[model samples]
Target: MSRDIDYGNLMHSAMRGLIKTVLQDVADHGLPGAHHFFITFDTSHPDAELADWLADRYPGEMTVVMQHWFDNLVVGEDGFSVTLNFGDAPEPLYIPYDAIKTFVDPSVEFGLRFESAEDEDEEEPSADPMPPAINTDHAQEDADTAQKSDAQVVSLDSFRK
Candidate 1:
């Protein structure tokens, strides 16, 4: 009996399905009542497509709120695309499910955070399983040298004094 299943991956997939379901509902019936979404995703992810200006402004990760003025909201199995207004100009944004970091609906006080697969894949694994043994003597000497350096420590007690 192996209980060591990949629950995290399964949970991620389930959450993504929730996002797809919600987006599909929005496409079919529009955002119900006051429910709006705050979607945060990686702009640098290969699957994501943003306008040049948007990519320039948000080179890392960006969060977009979908509330008042947005159109052409299309929810696909793996991704979604929507035309949103920025400075009175409509710009299309394409976001893949894997790139998404967080999804929130503040009105309902609901939120979910996702681990980016791209980021995980990019992380370099350690060469050796066991870390190299630390040399305490060298480390202590280094600490002593740092203490003797020109670094200044300002204590909060000085302000009180």
Candidate 2:
């Protein structure tokens, strides 16, 4: 006996909830409360372009924060672009919707995640494993070193812990 799943339509249906929450705030109030997005993506995608200098500086994955200070903020049907302050340098970047990998907001208790183009091209590196927790976003910090304000990066195994 065999059974099949309509995974494409199933995933599309689930992602709708995440997209709704994130876009709703941006659409209605121009950004919700103190919550902002930290979207990480592939800078080399066909529809992607960042300052050549930044592309070289962060070759693999770079995370950008979407907050009020951004300029030329526009969400298009295909992609989005805005001027973001990288340290003291303000750089403009364009990212295709397809390039987006993960969207995390530490301000809220929720997270919106997606896969990267590279994910289909190769197998991901293996890592140490663990158990599960109440909130998968929770992470550990070095009491003497790591800053308190950093975004949480829970271990993938933390979901099972």
Please give the RMSD of candidate 2 to the true structure.
7.9
Q: Residues 3-115, candidate 1: write the lDDT tens digits.
A: 77666677778888989999999999998886766677889999999999889987887777677678999999789999877666788999999787777665565667665
Q: What is the TM-score of each candidate against the true structure?
A: 0.70, 0.63
Candidate 1: the clashing residue pairs are none
Candidate 2 lDDT, 1-161, residue by residue in tens? 99877564356445544554455457556776767666767777778989898788767767666654566666666667767766557778888766765555656634444533343355764261111111212222132112213445432222321
Top-scoring candidate (lDDT): 1
- For residue 150, model 2's alpha carbon misses the true position, in angstroms, by 8.7
